[model samples]
Target: MGLLVKGKWYDKWDYNNDEGEFIREESQFRNWITKDGSAGPTGEAGFKAEPGRYHLYVSLACPWASRALIMRSLKGLEDMISISVVNTLMGENGWTFEEEEGVIQDPVIHADYLYQIYTHVEPEYSGRVTVPVLYDLKQNKIVNNESADIMRMLNSAFDEVGANDKDFLPENKMTEIDEINEKVYGTINNGVYKAGFATTQEVYEKEVTTLFDALDDIEERLEHSRYLVGDEITEADWRLFTTLIRFDSAYHGHFKCNIKRIVDYKNLWRYTRELYNEPGVKETVNFDHIKKHYYRSHKQINPNGIVPKGPELDFSLDK
Candidate 1:
């Protein structure tokens, strides 16, 4: 709900005055860890891919962090890289490591707040401390916090360290992957936030209608094909799947993006169940964390902080 100013934390949530929409901050660290120790976007060299050299800081409630978790689990990098989950409900500062179920307390530095970790790397760091932070153990700094870049890094960089062989972003399909990622991010991934945090009725209507319109397009696309990109499951599918899986549970009601639930969409519903059934993917999702965080954290949206109990999701049972 807040950000750091010159390494000082503040508690201010005034993005939306009339509407309760949400606006995401830009990620700070843009560096990458390539296979040949090459520099990416930003940062110095010598970030060679090695086993047990990196750790991921994430929050289960965050879709951006969830994307990295999916890639980490699918790539079989559990042993290579460690992870710490911050509490879902962002408090005065932002993501925290409060002792809770499925939440990993800060291990390396024993810090309570996530911004502390950011300041540890750069004392004067001025930005929002977001999740899916790829920390470099050797350098004692953050390698990358951008989820899209992290997804690509996890997909390819750690092969020498025995990470999973599955390539979510195959070279031949990079063009298509990029195309789908843009649409999904604009309409679905960030669309709900635009709706929930919209400052005006016109803005909310525009975003919500766009959100459902994008969903309808995806639903129709999935009706014929098994995945978004051809029959093979690509990075695009997994990235979109996390948002769809969370739509009915959180965005539909919490974000006021209730045009229609993914459950109401025939193709999207089945496709969501299918993705949830993926071996490592399902384990990363914690509905309790997701529900409690959104409902309790955003006091502006739900003043009572009371979470609903119905709309049970049986992703495990069957289609």
Candidate 2:
């Protein structure tokens, strides 16, 4: 919840606006990597597909960063792209690779904090140091930090260099996927944060209501369809999976998004278990990191910083 100002670090959280609504900042880096060194849908070009040329910085606790990790596993890019995971606790320094369980330290720059990597890319970098950061080691710069863009890039950018040929963004279903992604991103994905971090009661009520409405709509949709888009799992499903997986565990009580838990909706609960049981998808999930980061990092919300140990969720597919 901290940001860098003119290359200096400040421990603060300014995500709320005058209306007390949580506003997520747009990622600063927007470059893309193409299979043939061509420019992607956005940003400049020349980032070609190559093995061992890109590194991913992520935190298992973060849903945004988890998108890239899940895509990496689904697209079979584990060998093509290296990854470094930060410690679950986001202390004053903000996302450190401090030696701890589940922390995978940065091997390229050996930086202490995540912001150091941003400043290393741009000496006077000024922005929120968020992950999943897609760094180009050959250029020694961040190719992208936006999770949505990074996930798309990982979906097919490295196919020439042994990435799986899975087409999460198939052309035939692009329109439907885009439509679904737009609604889900606003109401469900970001809506929970808006409700949880609201400074006023009015903002919280509005956001929380919108969140459940979206969930209800999705529950109805899944009643007949196996996945979000088509018969097989698509990018849309994975995008929503990150938020849904964290909803009952973190968002319900911690974020005050308690209109109803995902498990309460029979269809949604079954859908979540199906996705969680997907190949390599379960491996990307770490409930311990997810619970720790939300409870401990957001001191403004949980002043005591006492991590909860209950709420035993049944992600089991058996019933």
Candidate 3:
């Protein structure tokens, strides 16, 4: 994972602490897009939700970025917002706009690397150059880089601006959704990383165990409710879906989250299939990019960088 240091590129993959635990970098840009150009829950104002004024940058390989992609598709914002797809392999230069199959060129400013977008916004910026960036062409600044925030904004902000009025995060279930999001995020969403990137065996074992425990809990819960919160699909389900969708393909073997394949759990297997069958939702998944990035990008994990070819995943397998 290369990062920008004071606006400069540094090719590094270190994410461990003294305790040998993986530490994910926090998102830097926090601005939000709202209907009235007002400040969001935790961001500044003026990033209005308007058609043809915003652009999205994402990597199909990234789960966080895929969250925003899924929300965009679910809300029917494809025509309202534009997007650029980065190359699957993130090398020394970080996320690049390299011309490749399934890769869309960066139309805004025609920058080569994703970091250029960040540096252009703030020349002296310092942080990881991540994707699923919401750019405001009018202001020429990043609206937000946090996937959760972007997902929520896409769900509601653009409704008045021609986006479909489907709210995954309903007001009545906000409290319950937030609570589930917290648990799922820590133990399942980020847990695979903690286990895969752990510098010590102790950390890996502890994280892997906790991850399976959480999966077991989710498996139990899915037996009762079709969705995470209730019978109706919500943002919580979408949030966890990104991670689960990639569990068998990337996290299971590549990230060492092999305690159980999602297919082994009857309820989770069925739920994943149900979500994948959602109209417009399946279009967002790119298994080719997902496998290549995890196996090729992380040199420290797989020094030879050999992408795997087995364990064929059929989302419709057990449904």
lDDT of 2 by residue, 130-190 (tens): 9999999998989999999999988888887898799899999999999999999999999
Q: After superposition, how far is residue 292 of candidate 2 from its true place, in Å?
A: 0.4
Off by over 4 Å in 3: none
Residue pairs with colliding backbones in model 1 are: 20-196, 20-197, 21-196, 21-197, 21-198, 22-197, 75-164
TM-score of each: 0.96, 0.98, 0.98
TM-score of model 1 vs. true structure: 0.96
> 1-319 in candidate 3: lDDT tens per residue?
6898899999887678899999988898899889998898987889888899999999999999999999999999999889999999999999998988899998888999999999999999998899889999898999899999999889999999899888898899999999999999999999989999887889999999999999999999998998999999999999999999998999998989998999899999999989998999889999989998899988888889998886776787444
Off by over 4 Å in 1: 14-22
Candidate 2 TM-score over all chains jointly: 0.98
Report the lDDT tens digits of candidate 1 across residue range 1-319: 7877898887887565554455677787888898888886676777888999899999999888999999999999999989999987798878888888888877679989999999998998877778889999898989899988899888989987798689888889989999999999999998888888786788889889999999999989988898999888899988998898788888888999997888888888888988888889989998888888888889878989888885687775355
Best-to-worst lDDT order: 2, 3, 1
Candidates' C-alpha lDDT: 0.87, 0.92, 0.92
Q: Give the runs in model 2 whose Cα sits over 4 Å from its true position.
A: none
